[model samples]
Target: MGEVVFWTIIRTAIVLPLLWVLKSYLNVDLWWTVSIISVYGVIIHPAVIHYRLFNEKNEEIIEDTLCSTCEHFDKTAVLCLKHDEHPTRDYLPCDGIDWSPKSSDKSQNVFDE
Candidate 1:
């Protein structure tokens, strides 16, 4: 996830200057249209695909592993906050000793309710 955000920033950093340079040559309306499409095609699309791939790769770990249910588990990063370790389908930071329910139904979900 961090990598996705990192690369998105990198892409934005690259494309933004090119968009500026293109603006000097193209008509304003067409430049804006092209800028939007180029940003989406080059930056947003890859980040989204990378995110999907990252999610797909971690699917089993997220859904089946003991860390998946643990309070210390961070599903976004697949990390154990207390142990500062990444949990996988086969490896648990606490070896199941620290497993607990992830209370998404608590305060964070209050707005939804």
Candidate 2:
């Protein structure tokens, strides 16, 4: 996720200046069209693709692993917050000794009710 955002920022940093330079050469209507297309093609599209790939690669670790249900697990980063380590399907940072179940919103709501 951080990698996706980092690369998107890098692409924006690169593309924006080029678009600014092109604005001076092209007419208003053409520049608007080109800028929109360029922004989507260069920045948005690649970011979406990279995010999808990142999710695909981490799907198992995020969904099926024991760490996924732990209170310290961060689904977005697939990291154990307590241990400050990334967990894989085969590896756990705390080795189950420190594992704790994630608190459920539904259970909280029921108790409140």
Best by lDDT: 2
Model 1: ten consecutive residues of lowest lDDT? 100-109
Candidate 2 accuracy as lDDT: 0.92
Clashes of each: 0, 0
**Tens digits of lDDT, candidate 1, 1-113:** 88999999999999999999999999999999999999999999999999999999999988888787778888899899989999877788788888766787355667667
Please give, for residues 1-113, the per-residue lDDT of candidate 2 as tens digits: 88999999999999999999999999999999999999999999999999999999999999998888788999887789999999998999899989877789447767899
TM-scores for all predictions? 0.86, 0.91
lDDT of each: 0.88, 0.92
